[model samples]
Target: MKTRIKKMSDDLLWIFYPTLCAACDRPLLMGEECLCTFCKYYLPRTHFHLQSINPVAKHFWGKVPIQAATSYYYFSKGEKVQRLIHKLKYKDRKDVGMYIGQLMGSDMKDSPFPKPDIVVPVPLHEKKLKLRGYNQSDFIAEGFAKSMNAVFEPQMVYRNKETETQTRKHRFDRYMNMDNVFSINKELAASDKNILLIDDVITTGSTLISCAEALLEIPGTKLSIASIACA
Candidate 1:
């Protein structure tokens, strides 16, 4: 009886303030979420987890030692992926990350991708985190951890320095901007355990490279990387 009432209430509220799809801006039907079914179906999944030497892994070649790397989707400008990401990062829709993470986790269930003992999201600086009121990546990592049955350790890595946005920076300049920016918590470090680093997106991968370098400092730690999308 209570569930019926809640559903009715939601339907009434939706009628007055319709929830639009993040990608297409269409009013979402009942039971649809941040994205409609059509957008979700065609979101450009990379399926990189199925390949060992995929492009994401190759990007880290000679730069950092990662067991493997994959991204759930291919991101492009003015596309559905970008719109979904913009909603998550700039529009306070953290659930978008969780939704995407759960989908990514499900897709990796039978793949050859290495499972990690711990899942950690790339941290945002204190100032940026304060302004944002949340780390969007945390929801992604949290949902992924739940689906993967791994430990979610958001504090395992810390961002000590506030760096400028890499949106307009060149590759080398982005690498320099992210240098010495991340540090790991010694107490949380698990020696000889696999750690999966999560990020929302990978462009030049400079940020992930810096985070991976810090995570590798832990003795006997095997590191891997995953992201919501690759640009």
Candidate 2:
């Protein structure tokens, strides 16, 4: 009887304040976190975490020496993963990022990669952060930190200036734009720990490479990279 009452209370709250799926923009069913059931099953999973030479890792081949790199899902044009990312990035659906991060963290717990000493989210420019009211990647890192029982440093690296979107830029242009864009904070640098860098997505990987380069400048620091999705 108590469980039924709690269910009815939840239903009434939903009726008054419906929560929609980040991917499909439809009302989420009871117990659903972010995506609807169909969308969740249909999301393009990358399975890159199980592979050593996947596209995600290849993106940094010879550019940076990362211990490991992987993404949770594959991103394609007009796909559910793309839609989910768009909502998390532009529609203020930070819960989506956190949910995905938690799932990824669970998988990593069983993988061979050593648990990182610290987790750092790729930083957004202050102007963009102010406009968005939150850094989606930081929320993602928070989920990973909780599940992995590791320290989360949301401000380990910072964007020194606003950068143009890399979506339309060539590979070289993207690298040029991201070069030296991140600066490591001295407090974070002094730890000299193995770090897991977190981000929402990995496309050209310019951003992660840039952040990794900054961290590598610090003595005795090692880096790995993870993201919610990859393109």
Candidate 3:
């Protein structure tokens, strides 16, 4: 009886405030959440998790030691993926991140992707966190951790300083800008643990690298990386 009542209430709510798909902005069906069925079908998956040495993994070669690295989707400018990410970051649509991260987590289950002991999201500086009201990556990591059965430690890393956005910076400049920006929480740090670091996107990988470096400071910590998209 309660289920039937809730359904009727939801239907009435939809009539007044329809929940549109995050990707296509289409009215979502009863079973649909965040993305429409067509948009979810068309998301560009990298399938990099199946390969040992994908482009994402190659990006970190000779730079940092990683157990594995993969991105769930290929990100392109001015496309559905970008729009979805924009909604997650700027539009206060955190469900989009969680939805995408859950999809990624489903892919990783019993797959080539290494199981992680802990899952951590890239942190935002206090100023940005306050301004944004939430860290976008936390939602992503939360969904991922749920599916992977890993500990979600959103505060595992702290951003020490605020830096300018990396969107317009050159590759080298991006690296310099992220240098020494992250530090690990010693209380949460543990040795001989496999850690999965999560982020929304991977462009030049400078941000992930800096976060990985801080987490790697703890002894016997093996790091892996995953993101919603890779540009």
Candidate 4:
């Protein structure tokens, strides 16, 4: 009875506020669609998935030796992609992250990149996780795992220290501060696995590089990366 009541309540809420696209705020029709048709076709894709040395990979050229890297879309400031990401991170729209992840996963399904054995999302500090009630990267990983037919290991990595936000920090400062912020959970390590590290966005690639650095500590682990957007 409780489950049924909860389902009915959710149904009523959806009726009161219809499902809308994250990109354009238009009502979405039934069947697995997230973005409106206009937004779907018009949104700028990075096409990095099809290239070996794309801009996303170039960001980490000298910093880390990632096996592969790609971003689903190019992020232009003050555009729909930026707005969608803001809502996903700040406004608690986790669905937006998952929706974008699913879209990217579908695109990557046919790409030339090698398949990954597991997906690992960049972890949030315990305090931040408690405050937000969820990790946005975990949601993105869940969507990617479903579409890519790979395992999603939410606890494979963890943030050991809480660092300041990297919003206004210079690139070098970000790299320095983020270096020791992440550590791998030794209990969850799987030997010789190809791990696909996931995050919401890639700016200087500092955060992802930090996480990858920790993951690399584990012997025989290969690392790749994916993100919703690249700035």
Candidate 5:
């Protein structure tokens, strides 16, 4: 009876204010959550986790030692993936992060990727966190932790300084801006544990580099990175 009542309520709600897909903006069916089935099936998957020398992994070469790194989707200008990211970051859509993380988890489940003992998100600056009311990466980390059977440490590492925006900045400028911006708690990262550092996206990867540098200092901690997309 509860299920039937819910079905009726969903139908009525759809009639009054139908749901729409986050990526495609199509009207969602009653059972669809966050995105329509079609979007879920067709959203681009990078499959970088399946390979040994994926682009994401190579991006860190000579910079930081990482066991592996890959994004679930390829981000491009004027694309549905871009739209999804915009919603996740700027539009207060935490569900978009969780959905993408869950999709990403499916790839990690049986892949060559290293299993993580603790999942840590790239920390948001206190000012940015105040403006946004939540860290988008934490939402993604939560979903990934749920699927990967790992502990989620939302505050293990944090932004020590607020850096200037990376937008339209040169790679060197981005690097300088992010340098020493992140600091980690040594005791929390733990020794002899594999730590997966997660974020919403990777561009020049300066931000991740700063965070990884701090995380790697933890004795016996192995580091890997994952993101929702790579531009």
Candidate 6:
């Protein structure tokens, strides 16, 4: 009876507040989660988790050696995926990150994706972190940690230099700019363990490469990458 009453109260509150889908801005129905049924079906998924040599893995070829790479969705410009990214990054909607990460974790739970020793998010520079009041990717990492039962290490590495956004830069420029800009923690560096590197989004895979390079400095450290979405 108590559980039913709480559910009823939550339902009553939603009628007054009208919860909307984060992706499509449609009113959420009784059974819908973060995204509406239409948006969930329409959103492009990479299904990269199923392949050993997916496109995301190919991006790191001849660059960083990664165990595997997967992204939850394919990002298209002006799409609902961007709306989810916007809310998570700019609107202080940290739950959005957790929800996406949980979905990714659930997918990989029974897949061939190797289990990780720990989950680390691409660290944000202190200045940007201060302005944003939180690291959006940290929430992603947390959700993944919970689902995968891995340690969530938010401070495993940090941005040593604040770099320009990679949005307009050429691929080479992005790689060059991010090089040597991150530093891994000694605790993580001293071990030969698998680390699951996480981020909110990936484009040209420059940022993940930079981060993986830092983690590889650790003896016997194997790297795998996961992101909420990728272009």
Q: Evaluated with TM-score, which candidate comes out highest? A: 3
As a whole number from 0 to 100, the lDDT of residue 72 in candidate 2 is 89
lDDT of 4 by residue, 92-157 (tens): 898887778788888888988657889989999999999988899988998898889999999989
What are the Cα lDDT values of the candidates? 0.92, 0.87, 0.91, 0.87, 0.89, 0.89
Predicted structure 1, TM vs. truth:
0.95
> Which lDDT tens digits does candidate 5 get at residues 51-168?
8698888889999989899998899899999999889999999998887777788779899999899999999999999998889999899889888989999988989999888998
lDDT of 1 by residue, 1-231 (tens): 999999999889999999998888999998898889998888788989999999999899999989999999999999888888899999999888888888888888778999878999999999999999999999999989889998999999999889998999999999999999999899998889889999999988999999999999999999999999998
Error of 1 at 40 (Å): 1.6
Model 1 residue 125 lDDT score: 93
Name the Cα RMSD for model 1.
Answer: 1.4
lDDT of 5 at 112: 93
Q: Which residue runs of candidate 5 sit more than 4 Å off their true CA positions? A: 1-3
TM-score of model number 6: 0.93
Which residue pairs overlap in candidate 6's backbone?
A: none
- Model 5 global lDDT (CA atoms, 0 to 1): 0.89
State in Å the error of residue 14, model 1. 2.8
- Pairs with backbone N, CA or C atoms under 3 Å apart (clashes), candidate 1: none
Clashes of each: 0, 0, 0, 0, 0, 0
Residue 221 CA displacement from its true place in model 1, Å: 1.2
lDDT of 6 by residue, 1-231 (tens): 999999999999888887789998989998887878887677888889999888888888899999999998988889899999999999989888887888788889999987898899999999999999999999999999888888899998999999998889998999899989999878655487789999988889998999899888888888899999888
Question: What lDDT score is found at residue 40 in candidate 1?
Answer: 81
Which regions in candidate 3 have their CA more than 4 angstroms from the true location?
Answer: none
* Residue pairs that clash (backbone atoms under 3 angstroms), model 2: none
**Number of colliding residue pairs in model 4:** 0
